[model samples]
Target: MRKRVTMCQWLSDKIDDEPEFLDNMWFSDEAHFLLSGHVNSKNNIFWGSTPPDHCLQRPLHSVKCTAWVAISTHGIIGPFWFEDDDERSLTVNTERYIQVLRKFWVALGRRRGIDRALQWFQQDGATPHTSDRSLEWLQQRFEDRLISRRCHPEWSPHSPDLNPPDFYLWGYLKDRVYEHNPQTIPDLKAAITAAIRAIPREECRRVIENFARRIQ
Candidate 1:
């Protein structure tokens, strides 16, 4: 609790000191979207003379897809699917996370002609994100601007409420994605991608504005 408070203050001050910090910072995180988890009772509606018996069967080991994204005031960086070398779906580990970052993040920067020095990267203290090699790779690019477990001011562990992706993006996407009631993994993935692309730039700016207020 103390650490969380301290870092919040530190970040709040940093935001005050650097006017462009929020816009340049890329806050990243991952989430698992399950097919079975899409079941919402409120969405089930039937109009008939008699009440109909409805049963929604969900698999025991539900098929799911994990997606990673980075958002900032500039806009969202990705809705990248976490897949293996063979193009099979998989959970995130140190190796896979590093691979995705190198492939997608690096490629995006190069393609857009973005200078590494102008942007800062933020990640939470998840084991895969904080491992020695991971920190080293982030340090090589972001230098002192990297925000994570061992970085300068460090990030609070139990502070998802502080991350834009956590506080806003995931919930925002899930609400619309599941609204379509995707029954298959492919359908879920399509819905997610569509929802991501639908987020307007104005909303992103407002999200960062809210973030600034919270940290302060």
Candidate 2:
């Protein structure tokens, strides 16, 4: 659970050695997922149109899919939903992925002028993130605010328990959004927005602060 305190320690020292994780004082990149099916009966029935012989629309198994997202404790930076497939069609690609990150930076600094550069940023070593192109872009665009980006191998994608938005945030959102079956994409999207807004700041802190304990 405790590999090293590279991220927090560095950010802490820069901002003064004070606690940061739970104080609503940090930022991180996150991904969002939209599941296609629910944990209903093993042999549930879908009441939509189907072949004369087919009884329902339910798949034989659960179809959980994900979207690439970058968010922080303050609020959502942005979200990019991937093309939905049977799930196998999805592969983690860093090249196209960096585009989403680029868009996030634009929103944080250029569009909104929130100056996310002043905030701490953390993310996993997904292929695009570590690629020469992505880093080069970061170096070019963020030349002045280079200090804003926090680098830590330990904070990369391999570790999810440390990031509560995956475990805690989505579940909270899903429970609220999937209150009923979402037959279409728009139905699902509305649910997602509602859920994201509902999660309290304190709840997010609990998950991130106790990340190490949870991992252990």
Off by over 4 Å in 1: 38-58, 85-87, 110-114
How many clashing residue pairs appear in each of the predictions shown?
0, 3
- The window of 10 residues in a row where model 1 has the poorest summed lDDT is 37-46
Tell me, by TM-score, which candidate is best: 1
Per-candidate TM-scores read: 0.86, 0.61
Each model's lDDT: 0.81, 0.51
State the local distance difference test value for candidate 2.
0.51
**Which stretches in model 2 have alpha-carbon errors above 4 Å?**
1-35, 38-65, 84-92, 110-113, 139-158, 200-216
Give the per-residue lDDT digits (tens) of candidate 2, residues 1-216.
Answer: 233455445444543444543332333444434456454421224575665774567555444444455445455644455443432324456666566666766666753435554444555555556567766766565543332223432353344445555545555665677778777666676567666666675655565556535433
TM-score, structure 1 vs. true: 0.86
Query: Cα lDDT for residue 49, model 1?
Result: 92
